[model samples]
Target: MPASLALSPTPAPARGRLWRTLRQWWAVLLFGAVAAVYALSPSSHDARSRNATARLLHATSWQALPWFALLSALISLALIRTLVVTAQSYGLSQFALEMVVRVLLLELVPLGAALFLLLRVALAGDLLPQADPAGGLAPHALAAERWRLELLPRVLALGFAVLALATASGVLALLLAYTVVYGVTPWGLDSYTRMVGRVFDPAVCLALGLKTGLFAVAVAVVPLASALQEPYAAARRAAGFAVRSGTRRVLAVLVLLQAASLALKFL
Candidate 1:
């Protein structure tokens, strides 16, 4: 082969990108495993860890209450009204409640919660404090300190935020859906409940629970993993890359999970 041909850079081999993706995924999995172990371990319940977790939890979930509630309500109302009108026009009004429950509560709520927290965390960037890894502390001690003081609290807060937001929004959406479909009469409550109950059978309930947990994990773990895996020397650039890549991967996973749930339910 000619010198130029042999020495010329290969077009950034697909293998490099593939390996990066695999590494990211491995990081996520490892972080999750460690988090679970730490959460269940004795140290997690100590006063300092518990206090940090409480503060972060309050920041992520409690402080977001007003905006989250408003946004969820608005989205639910718009979607519910649109579906109800369309159903009425098509002479399928009877199925409107079921459709609303499936689309808004089962689907949108979890995804919206995940996206909301993801955005919140992204906006509040630099969640982890700057630390010198070479500051004479042992690797294991430093790792433990980082986990207890920073990573665990933040991850737990985000996960809890997802769960809280989804649950609250889902309940509100269900109530609003009923009101939109059947008006504000107590008599309609029985039928509304029945329709919702029928829509959410055992299999669906399981799937919804599993999907919510997965969404939480994706939102909580992926970004932190991406940032942590990058070199601390170029923290700023690493953060930008982490945010972009993590957001894309999280969105892709969310879409895939939603699609799979829909397929299981309807296809």
Candidate 2:
């Protein structure tokens, strides 16, 4: 291969692909920044916005917490029991606690929380009301108003739901794992805490936290981005297609994030 040829200007196709990728990510980042600013602005703390946020938060988190906790506890118990039996039979009993922490607490809880919030929001379609910009405001102003009054609160609510559910269910799973693996006694508390601490070292903890935040952001942002991509007329005309495509986008982002997390943790 000639040096000149190798060092020559990049091909058009490659440059085009790179440009497209940059453009896509830039849009996502820009949207996130605008949303964040709106969410944090003092004007957003108005009574109406606060009330909307609180109501949505209650519906998203409180309403789902009990059922989610019950389901997580049952599943955790079954898995813990099975893991204990299997480990004891296979002479790996000592590693059961670590396995539960890694698999159940770090992985399952966050993913399940994100999925639950996604499903709940999907089922309760159009959680945000359409805001009408008064006094013949410009398109940009109307969009800003909508983001502040309508989208920001719902996204905040759903994001809160994801974190709340993940935290609550994760704690419950840990307790259940301990109870099932070591009985209802305080004797194993030290060993259990040590193992959990070991499993959740700085690197693992960082990855888990990042993965959870990414999951929440993906769950909250993808649908909104997809909805915005469609013009009002087209969205109204092909609502089902818009929904199906949005779901696919959300799932793709989630799977990608999960794969990256696993790679970071184990690779």
Candidate 3:
């Protein structure tokens, strides 16, 4: 064998595959950004789109509101009672309501909203138009109309759902915190306002809003975008793998957003 004929370590194919993978991922991210922007922009604000958005708000958020509200109230009660009791035992009862406001509103409720949409709407897109007779359309054909009619509304609903549910539960927890702490007296209102207001300063409010928005986007995009790729329905049959991958991606995005938020805040 001649030295010139020796097989060199050809990195081209591997690097080409790597670049292709990166490009595909970038395309998916671009699609999600465009989709979110379109859904939010004035161009998608026509009457029919508005109606579709309303229908989705009804389905994704309103219909689930009662169940979520009840469940969150019950959960809040349990947590509030536990925190109050624990704080009382430790003689930190004066700080109990503040703790409740901070823990329940600033952290837990947003996390719950993220999980709710991930389970309820984001990954449920396959079941949206399927089981219907007209769902046999090809992937390319299902791009625009299906996305507009079926996908965008649901994504918007999920975002607003997170906001609505988080705000609702935050209010509920605040009231519950007051009730559990002060026993239905109006005299504690001033102190309650001061404590909650102090904790929820403008910066904290902005951060919480930003966190929820980021979480909503993470829940909406990561799973749905992955599941909405070509051969959509067949992927449903292999849903276990799809779900695991989607969950990992969602968690990764969420972790990054959370870290960035924390960095901006404390670091």
Candidate 4:
């Protein structure tokens, strides 16, 4: 056979790409393990990390408060008003608050918070470095330092921000819901408590707690795991493919978790 007809040698780059793909999967699993460990005692992280995280948390939540608060207020009011008005039109005004609580506070707020944080983190880009076997002790120290000072703080801060924003917005939305339904009157207090209590039963409360916590965790972990924790060579060779694939995989996991929660509640 002619030399050209002989099977072309597998290019070094192709082999490298394949190997990088394998390592990416391993990194994903490791991310899950690390994220789980981090979540269990987020309050116990180091002081330096906490300080850095505080700054990030501020950026993620406090700095953006006016816009988020305003947007949430507007949307909540629009939704609550629509529900209340429609309920009254249909002679179901008594159940309007319950509908608002379940739909807005429990469902939309957590999801909207997750998407907002995800978009923010994606724009910030990845800051992690892949472990190099030949890089010796100094490199390991650098990775550890990076993880502690830069990476961990960002991850934790973003997570906490997700929680904070969802919670703050949720509370605000609740207040708006009440005002829209009852016109800020003192007499509605007892009625409000009874309705809220009925809507937020033990099972519902547990589900909302779990869903919000998971949303926070997902927004924090997915972007970091997708971009960081991969070798420079591999990343350079296929940056777009790596990013798109990793991001979709992480997102798929998040969607599955959300689906599981729905199933728990309804199925």
**Model 1 agreement with the true structure over 1-267: per-residue lDDT tens digits:** 888877746556777888867866876678778878787888776788889999988888999988999999998999999999999999998787788898887888999999999888778874544434332222234478778888888888888999999999998998898788768889898888788889889988999999999999888877776666555666665667767777787888889988888898788
What are the TM-scores, per candidate, against the unseen true structure?
0.89, 0.82, 0.80, 0.77
**Per-residue CA lDDT of candidate 3, range 126-162, in tens?**
4233322243232334456666776677667767887
lDDT string, candidate 2, 1-267, tens digits = 888878848888999999965654555556566767777789877888888889888888998999999988888888878878888889998887788778898888999999877777666666623323232122234466667667788778877888899999999998998888878999999988888888889988888888888888877766655455445545556556656655777788889988888787678
TM-score winner? 1
Superposed Cα deviation of residue 233, candidate 1 (Å): 1.8
Task: Note the residue pairs that clash in candidate 2.
Answer: none
User: How many clashing residue pairs appear in each of the predictions shown?
Assistant: 0, 0, 0, 0
Off by over 4 Å in 1: 1-12, 126-142
Instruction: List all candidate RMSDs to the true structure.
Output: 3.2, 5.6, 4.6, 5.7
Top lDDT: which candidate number?
1
Ranking of models by lDDT: 1, 2, 3, 4
TM-score of 4: 0.77
Reference-based lDDT, each prediction:
0.81, 0.76, 0.73, 0.72
RMSD of 2: 5.6
> At residue 157, what lDDT does model 4 achieve?
78
